[model samples]
Target: MSRKRKETEVFSLSFLDCICCGFGAVLLLFVLTASRKADQMDDLQSKIMAVIGDMEYEISLKDKEIERKKATLAVETRLAKDSGARLDETKKRRTELEDMLKLLLQQLAAIEGELGKLIDEKENMPTQEEKVPIPIPNPDRRQYLTGFDILGNQVLFLVEASGGMTADTLVDAAEWADKPEKERREAPKWKRVKKALKWMIANLKEGSNYKIIFFNKELVPLEVGFGRDWFDPMDPDLTVEVLNAIDDITPEGGANLEKAFAIVNELPIEPDRLVLICDGLPTLSDSYAGGGNQVMYDDRVAMLRAAQNALKLNLPVNTIMYPLMPDPGSAVHYWRLANSSDGSMISPSEGWPDI
Candidate 1:
């Protein structure tokens, strides 16, 4: 029995040793796998660090680019500001030019008046056998002045008081009003305007009633007076005052043409003379796109608003545009106004004559 027991014990011990050897082999294989895995993880970590470093460098480059753009933007902004200042200066000069023009207009009016008086006297004189009647120069030979001789008709001068007026027309009016009478007559303004005014004022006979009005977006009196003496066509003071007051004229803050038409409609006067002197078209009135340009409601709306208003007034409108621009309607509006009112013009059927 002892010998059998000893043999079984030896077998069991051999079995245990075999299992220990297998366990050792498995542990060795696990160590090899772990070492390979650790090597792969180290490589991946190196690759990730390289990529991260590259990303940081790329980010730094982008930051430098952003700084360059900022510097360029600053330079551009400064240049634009300088350019804007220059533009403002140019606009100021333009206004000065406009003032000079108005002075010229007033001077022309004075000259025309003197010429008209001389011409009338010359025409009335009897032709003698020896004496020849000097032919009077006709400033407006295209159409003879008419219906102006009818007295008691109120003269409502619808002067344009748009922003454009501030530039030239009105400033000259100030200079003309304050200037000497002789200078007013001798200047090119009166030299051109004298003849026209004289012919128009001729209608103001002994006891005629009249009133002079200046308007843009509102109605203002240059000089308000009535009666025959009031219509004295020989009012040098009046001429000067009108020319000066005209300098104060300005365009509408925003064109509400309805206001202008309403003013005329509510005047409660019959047989009136409405003169409209403007450069551009109507803007800011009630119409498509809000009367003028939505982006910029610059000039008056050149559309048919003026024409429609003229139709509503049922009266002739004398539109004198100063150096009208942008073609077609810019110049042609005058003709439309004249035709609508059953009136005719002499020269500058499109725009105004510089002289």
Candidate 2:
């Protein structure tokens, strides 16, 4: 009985020891699992904190944007004033430019006028410039003589289309009718006249009337236009036909000075002038049957009466004489004609020039 009781005690002690070992192993496993779970939780918390930090940064940026917008709106309220200030600056610049332009225009106009005056004075005093004299009407005379009516009432040309002149001389003469006094003086009278004519045609006023009368024996109209010679002298818009026709006048002649003068008598308006352009004394000037030897004066001089009869009740004659040689007879005729109706005479110097 004692041996059996001791055996039972030993078995009980072994069972208790086994139970303690199993419990210690389970406790150790539970501790390890709990520590792993705690580590995973800490990692999740770190991720959540990082996301929170990004969201805070975004929120701060949004706050800054709102403040910037508010500042922009505050500044925009006075847009009208800002725009007006800029506009005023622009307007001031424009005004200054306009004033400068106006001053420049005035200066240009003054210069052009001065040039015109200088051109006019050159005719009276001897100068190379072909400046025609400005004839102010003599109040004492019963005539309608006036200065270069810038209104160029007529484009009358007393051209010397005589066979004696070279083709080049005629061409040159035709082109120089409108030259300035200086240029005219620099060249021959014939060439100067041509230059002057060309100048006139190219620079005539818009409302001026013009007629180109070429004459040797009979008077011939070369170019004609109402208000403005051929085309506006100041501004030309010439037709090809007119330009060709103007350039087509050939130098041919029978030289009856009286015939050209007679053209004035047939004018609808009294007459501007009987521009007697002659390089020499008139050939066959009088009636052949009057005395057979000398030309008759009564018939030739009768033109004066006819001129006086046909002229505007009080228009004077004006003479521009071109002679190869300065003949006393031409001077006498020009002098007589000019004084006969209080006209003026323009003749070349004493030297004889080639045609």
lDDT of 1 by residue, 277-304 (tens): 4544554444334433352322343333
Global CA lDDT of candidate 1, please? Answer: 0.51
Clashes of each: 37, 33
The model with the greatest TM-score is: 2
Candidate 2 — what's its lDDT? Answer: 0.53
Candidate 2, residue 78: the lDDT equals: 72
RMSD of each: 21.9, 18.0
**Candidates' C-alpha lDDT:** 0.51, 0.53
Error of 2 at 244 (Å): 4.6
Error of 1 at 284 (Å): 3.1
Q: TM-scores across all candidates?
A: 0.40, 0.42
| Tens-digit lDDT track of model 2 for 1-355 | 4565444465587899899999999999999999999999999999999999999999999999999998888788578679899889667656644554564476568779999999888657765756697775765333324422223355455565554332224456445444543444345444544543453344444665555667655666765445333334432234322444545655544455555555655656543433444554454332222344554445434433443344443444555556543234556665676677665556644342211
